[model samples]
Target: MGLAVVSLKKGEGRLLKSGGMWIFDNEIATIMGSFVNGDIVLIHDFDGYPLGKGFINTNSRITVRLLSRNEQTVIDEVFFEKRVRDAWEYRKKVVDTRSCRVIFGEADFFPGLVIDKFSDVLVVQSLALGIDRYKEMIIELLKKVLKEDGIQIRGVYERSDAKVRRQEGMELVKGFIGPEFPTLVEIEENQVKYQVDVKDGQKTGFFLDQKYNRLAIQKLCKNAKVLDCFTHTGSFALNAGIAGASSVLGVDASALAVDQAAANARLNGLEDRVQFLCRNVFELLPELEEKEEKFDVVILDPPAFTKSRSSIKNAVKGYREINLRALKLVREGGFLATCSCSHFMDYELFTQTIGQAARSAHKRLRQVEYRTQAPDHPILWAADESYYLKFYIFQVCSDR
Candidate 1:
């Protein structure tokens, strides 16, 4: 196929030169002939000077996600193999264990592909058209890399349920890539044990990116009464219980998730201390307030409310409502671990949203710590915008 040319207007090439990956729709001077989604494009200045190579997706606001700056570099199977192998090499050296985010999109220079390695197995999610088009080759590269690293290849599972796939006109795929499916795998972080279910759980069966934040909660949960809202699979509650919380209450709207949370609590033998509740958090929060129920530690880890710029206002409202209610439900001097995963919502806006929530609830907050995605989920420094995950551990007070 001939190289699809993408000409950027005037100074828009600065972002690309500064190591940014995304080229928004507004940046394009011309689409330059018809090109299908996921086609490799050669980005150039108006004068036809080569800028870089990237994966094109006209459907997305981010029209192109740059893959390489080298004009000679071809984004073929060999190129993908080298990128995937380089990602694995870094993980092996930096990550303390076998389980980690093996591929982190732009951070690894393979835009729109995220692979999480759990022991011998790899769970992959191709969120962009470019990555989806090369799924087979990527899988092949992953297998070769695992074998080269002397790691047994259990299977590669595709967990592409993310909304981005749908936007890219791809169907949701979840299944084993190899012969057999691994039943369970254990991962440890900061002395806490977590059982990951790559086949049937949320987001490759675990939120490994929150590993450190969970451990932070564990330290604060000692002898405390904990409440974990939107407790998918009981991770936060179970961790608190295992960390010696006197009692933990986990609430989620999904009964399936609640059931899984209970099973996980039982698996860790913490069912005696951790309780699961299947209920809408919005309604439950008010009820808890009415009942005068308060917790020493409250976790608010809701799913991303905003996926696009259009939904940002509603997302902020939802976030604020939940944070305000949770703040009210935490005892004075208690801890509130709050988080937002919406990339559209910047950290400053998120902090401001929480501050407004606290103000409306007539509560004061002292931020204890600020956290982001785990190390395995590396952020590209040039693309500061890619650092989407945000966590704030705050101490609630009555000095409003």
Candidate 2:
């Protein structure tokens, strides 16, 4: 049977034509042929002009995720091999390949599919039904490509258990993709070692997007008293300790994360200088301020306060509150590192919110540097979702 054809309404596919990957359900004008929900389909302009090809899923608000702009490009093992190889090569050139985001979903041209490499293990998250069908082939091709580079993948694990799967009419499932190996994988980043629990840890076990950001804080931390808020697994704190910080306090609400972080500190032999505490950072910050406890450097790496645009108001408030308290904890002429991982909190809005926090705290902020997610997690232009992280370092000073 011939493939189904999807035609876009006039002026409806502006995002798609401008290089974005998604075509929303409401933008489609008609389906000219019959096909399964997850099958590949041809896309066309309303005036009978061929546009491209993509996989279709009526269950999703994103109706079509374009696979290629070229109408004749075939979706097969050869095509997948090229995509996998290209993603790997790009990572090799731009970031550390020892452990990194090998394929970053939409940014790497594989919509709704994320593959993170932890040492020799691969954790896969397939979020959309359309790409879920081709996931196995993509993994095989990726493994073959890595093998050619003298890298042998020990195991492949699936973490397609995010809540977003329900929106695609798919059940959340996670387990070993092939043969099982020890889920406890150890990786080294910026000379800091970590025991990443691929089986039970958060978001494929670690946030590799902050890989370089953690490295960027080393110079600012040497011999400085540092406080790392929301320190999951003590990544930033551990980096500080490794950088010769006088003392580091890493705080998180999760006791499990605290324990793992302590273990990581021991792994690096920095347990004496770096301590893990299980406490609410929001409450702890105010207490520290009341006690006049100051830090030479304060790092705020909170989770996304809002994931959607509708709750941005509350998100802004949350961000502002934390930044205000954190600014108060920084000693005069000390440094502050703050970041937001919510794409909904765009660069401008996040920056503005921080400025409000500084004004409210009666502090002057000297901008040091601004950064985003590491090079491996490349931000695809026009595809706004891929550009989620916004990081900034500033020197905090007394208003005088």
Candidate 3:
């Protein structure tokens, strides 16, 4: 079939005009020519001006995810080779390529795809139906590119079982892209070691986006008591212990995660200094408060409370409750590190929520720094969804 042309309605592609990669179904005026869903299609302005090319999926609200802004661009192995190489090259310059986000979906201009490197293993997630069609080619190309840089990828795993795939008319599935190997992978970051369970662990085995954020809290933990809530795999707690913290307690409700966290503590030789607890943070925080327990540093790294905008109000309440409880536990002049991974909760809303929490806890906050996800998870400006993870560190002072 010839290239299908999708023309946008007058003044309907506002987001696209502003440099976003998505073209909604309602924004389309008409489709000229014939093509199947998940096929490459040309985009045209209402006046017949070429806007570029993208993959169209009628099953999703995001009808078209722009692949290239150049109309002449071809989609093939040659095209994917360049994209994969460019992504790897960018990571080498900006982050530790040993284990980092090699391809960050829209941020890397490969919308609907995410690839993370954990030691020698590659974890790939192809969310959109269009990208799923080329997933194999992209993975092979990425392996070739990394090999040129002296990196031998021992295995490739697919974690494309996200629920969102159904929205694109795709099946939920995950397995090895090639021959299966041990799913458990070991990785080191900020001088701390962890065993990542790629097959059954959280997104991409580990949260590589927080790589440097964990590093930032090291100095604050020296010879101090630390508390790390929602400590999946005990990342922050281990960092504290490695940084000479007197003691560290990591809490997570998941028994599996707690066991992994405890194992990680042992792996880092910090089992004595760093400990793991299986408990609901919401219940434990108040219990600790009643016991008058205080910590020199408290880190709240909760999983996203709300995945959609409709639930953002409840998400705010959750963030506020945790931050307030954490502030009350911070000894006078102590530090608190809190962050939200939800994109639905914008920066302004998150900051405002923290301020409310401070007031309720009667703690005066002195802002030390504001941070986002690590550089490897680049925030593409025009693509707002590419920018999540708002992190902040504050000094908590007793209200006089």
Best by lDDT: 2
TM-score, structure 3 vs. true: 0.99
Across residues 1-400, which tens digit of lDDT does each residue of candidate 3 receive? 5799999999888888788999999999999998889999999999989898999999999999999988999888998898888888888898987889999998888989999999999999999988988999899899898888898999999999889999999998899989999999999888898999999998878999888899999989999999999999999999999999999999999999999999999998999999999999999999999999999999999999999999999999999999999999999999999999999999999999999999999999999899999999999888999889999999999888
Model 1 CA deviation exceeding 4 Å by range: 31-36, 182-195
Q: Clashes in each model (backbone N, CA, C under 3 Å)?
A: 0, 0, 0
What digit string (tens of lDDT, one per residue) describes model 2 on residues 228-320?
Answer: 999999999999999999999999999999999999999999999999899999999999999999999999999999989999999999999
RMSD of candidate 3 to the true fold? Answer: 0.8
A best-first ranking of the candidates according to their TM-score comes to 2, 3, 1
Q: What local distance difference test score does each model get?
A: 0.86, 0.95, 0.93
lDDT of 1 by residue, 195-237 (tens): 7778788888888888778888988999999999999988888
Q: How much is 76 displaced in model 2, in angstroms?
A: 0.5
- In model 2, which range of ten residues has the least summed lDDT? 10-19
The model with the greater TM-score, 1 or 3, is 3
Model 2 root-mean-square deviation: 0.7
lDDT minimum window of 10 residues, candidate 1: 183-192
List candidate 3 stretches off by more than 4 Å.
Answer: none
